[model samples]
Target: MKRSAMVLLGLVVVALGLAAKQLPGVDGGPAAPIAGPQVAVGAPNRGSESVGVELGPLVIEGRGTRTTSVVGDGGTVVLAAGYGVRTSGAAPALRLSLERRVGSGKWESTSAPVRQDEHGLHVSTPPWSASGAAPATTIAYRIASASFIDAAGVAPAVRSRSVSVVYENQAAYTGLAAQIYRDAAPYCPTTAVRIADLMGDVAGDYQPGTSLIRIDAVVGTGAMARPEIVRSVALHECSHERQWLNYDGTNEGRKRMLAAAAAQFSSYDPMGVGATGPSGPLKSDIRPIEHAADCGAMALEPRGYLGYGGSCSPTQLEAARRLLTGGRY
Candidate 1:
């Protein structure tokens, strides 16, 4: 066949493959495929002849009464997906499938299959629920496979893709924000903490919930470096988070939590320290939290290999020690 004829033949094969089946919910016109947000997605390495697959914007919407008991009150939980597919002329028709609550003791299909169309593939399948099911906490959805014929032979290239369960009347992200607020509220001298990634001559405030944590996004002679380092810093701050959440929700409570944290720093895994705790140089303070937060940081080995300097200030350690030991010393 001539080059032009070969190209045309390839196109014809792909068109036929795409038109082979209509998914249960697809409209069957040119698809307006959804674009996935820029995110760091972790998928297992599955070597296949398949090219990259453009995932659609997946949204989970739900509506139901808020209560300690009872699942959705016939409330609607919709799973919508939109994506596009391109294939080799000789490949088989791409098949799309859905699976829910994966890895659980039992596997089940929550919704029927929908064919991919020119408009790409979309689904707004609502799960059936009675008014008396247990309160809905989460729903997990996945694409079982997108099979196509490739040079390697008949195979389902993409293993699976999933979206975390979304609660009703709430976005998946809003819940996370709310959780940050709730966890840090009491520790927060003010409403919320500020987070930033910038340059400063001096070390910035390292308050638990109040101070914004800085994450270095750039790379150069001077930068915060990688995400792991930033995350380790955040974990240090989260010690403050635990301080607030477990306390009595009062100033005295905050002090108590801090003091208790100081005491337990040695008991629990200190920063920088490995599973056995800090093994390096020690700080001046006898309190453990200081040891863990500062000196422990030096010991605990973070994934990013960002080295720890020292433990927290001795003043706070003494204050906590005074409280824990009832000021006897």
Candidate 2:
């Protein structure tokens, strides 16, 4: 077949596949498609996919709600429910109920008000307040439905799968840290404590011999509130951690790595102070690592604040891109 004809054939196949998926099953009649936002029910955890439940002619879909896990002042858990009727003719009157369970406790139910549309029905419960006492805890939620009643009387009940949420302290920072770690997981894998400690100045330094990142009193508590500062500093320190892991075993190896990085980003002084030439070899050796760390920070978060005027030269930016993409120190 000609190239154009083959391309046309491939398109046709994909179109057919999508059309088939939309069609009703052979055994059952036309399957009702339920659509809505994912429902999550806890702290720090996101909701899962929409669930479709068949209640005779009615097709109801329920989703869990999602919210930030941080409970600084207080937090609320949202439970959302949506549903659709599959059969034609007059739609039946329906109601949804939401229930919650924490730890090994009994289920508590709440009636959620329904809003109807041409497509389906939706309902959301009032925010369920989480106890501020515990630092972290998990909550599970499920959705149940009352029988759809029409002129013909009551129909069958509908039930949805259970979903969970996990609430915790510093949820925002922890979530951000988790994302950064995931992004750099292939190249650098460190503990949550290491990432959390990076927020403070004390645990910022990576010790080569011990393979431990020590907390040194360096960053102020107020700095933790600023995400850009935390991200920039974390990425910068993480780059150093990677370098230490790769080169700290041998002095000669470490020197060679630093020399390579320094050669690439040679425009800046290692001491971070605006100095002309370095007074000694130690300063010369240290400059590359500092430059690399800064470059790593810039590469991770280009728009983030990096202190010291929060600006990187064009050369330094280019070097950062290279280091990040090339997987180098």
Candidate 3:
């Protein structure tokens, strides 16, 4: 079966207009989704007089020069370096540097501040915006440590590092989506979002596969809004994923009943944007499908059974609670 595009009907993002809400940040054009091959570069070399240490999500396996390329022609590398000294758990001092290469020529290095933590070193370099003549060449860099003793059974005391190379590249945007994927994999397997392409109101589609739920970006927004919004939205949509699985992807029957119940909950639009009256268009022109969904959504919020957002007063929560839980306060 062909995959269905996510429905953006009756959405709310800066005034829902078609699938525009699905794509955020960049304009809705013919641009392709960002992803590319990983460039291979030389690793920083190490010597026998070096010590190796292991850190969470970071491994200084052995002293070796590593080369990684940025997405743009002129980018800056924020390299962090640190050392582990045997002084009552007090980590040693550290330093950092920023290097820039404007073209396909030699790298220009500059000093950067290094902050040391119990684990390692960290640095933040200025934005790399000048790469010489070639305005779009990749920025490559490497990190190494000063000559230190190879402590027995002790991790290497090399300069621990983390790099943040900035660029006005599409791949960087994809990296943002990749971050969302990382978060969705473990905690929100039933729901996910790639914000890079989310437009105005058109959110992604929800498909619950045999093992997990997949939400692809038809349109995405840039890395905007706090993660709390993402978490809340994803959690909200995840409830739909469960609903789909439980109802076998069809809520038509339940929607009818919920729609009837929602009338009692509705004094105005569920989104708090309009009014709902017997003589108004809300009763004649509005669709109850979304109201049913909103009913379920509001039911899940904290004290949301009390209904917040629309003209629907907190009193509606009492009715909704009774409908769902036999009037149990």
Candidate 4:
């Protein structure tokens, strides 16, 4: 190899060496991975670690840089840094755990079907995903010792350094959904929502029974690649919610009232002002319930991206405003 290539190789080895130093491996005898789940308080043998683990980002090319990754609500997080086991303790056991907390809320273990405790630690592993998050909540995590470590022998640190990753709901990572829900709150107090595959380009729809707004997961993936789309979806869905509550929100009466709204909004232009192509008739936008929802979204913001390809007329918007503000449907 050329001198330059040799030098680069040397640098890579040195970097790996330095990275390994962060999580020192056990030194006494060869370490063995502890087996089985060690979370139960009364288990005969919990588990132990050798190199244990460390927090760091996971690089797709290789190992993540030697630092905990930038955590989001339900996104990337460091997995095992250096895999190993602890064979030093008489009652050999290691306790690995993941915990989380909200603002000043009690810290609670969130270990689930995933292995809570492990003995072997690898240099790099696929990131563990976090879920069930709300907006602005801090989530803390760590791997630690369940049993006492023998200080006299060479054993891994009793507890892995505690680290944290703050993430948002995977479904609403962009905060647009939450914002939409909050914006629609005054008109309809309970603006509940769900994010699902929802198939193709369909961003969202207001379901009748549950009365919950549904945002499409397929389009909203990857930190909401297109926030505007999600935002528009939310606005449209919220409009439907407002429509439902505009009526007494009783059972069959609500159905009749919503149908009446669709009929009234049917003729209203969905493309608001400055709309050009897709010429002829944006049929879907003019459909009964969808038209009403589109108009409602237009009423929210006529010029804003209300639907797939349309907005409402000024007169339609005004009517929607009055209906949304306080008047009956």
Query: For candidate 1, lDDT tens digit of each residue in 10-40?
Result: 7643432322222221211111233422322
Clash count list over all predictions: 26, 16, 38, 15
Q: Model 4: residues >4 Å from true position, as ranges?
A: 1-177, 219-228, 270-285, 306-311
Residues 1-329, model 2: lDDT tens digits: 99988887676444323211211121011112334433222111124322223421221221112221211112232333444443223544456666667777987786555455443334333343333565455666566666654333344677656655554432233454444444444344422213433332232444331222222233223334245545555565556556544553222345566677767655553343322234313434334555566667666676444322223456666666555443453
lDDT, model 1: 0.35
Among the numbered candidates, top lDDT falls to: 4
Using Cα atoms with residue i matched to residue i, what is each candidate's TM-score against the true structure?
0.29, 0.34, 0.30, 0.41
Candidate 2 positional error at 171, Å? 14
Candidates sorted by TM-score, best first: 4, 2, 3, 1
Q: Per-residue error at 124 for model 4, in Å?
A: 55
Model 1, runs deviating above 4 Å: 1-57, 61-71, 82-86, 102-106, 130-133, 157-160, 166-329
Better of 1 and 4 by TM-score: 4
Model 3 Cα shift for residue 129 (angstroms): 2.3
Q: How accurate is candidate 2 locally (lDDT)?
A: 0.43
* Candidate 2 residue runs with Cα over 4 Å from true position: 1-186, 190-192, 195-203, 214-221, 246-249, 269-286, 307-311, 324-326
- Determine which window of 10 residues in candidate 4 has minimal summed lDDT: 22-31
Ranking by lDDT: 4, 2, 1, 3
Candidate 4 on 173-204: residue-level lDDT in tens?
A: 34545655554555544445555554443555
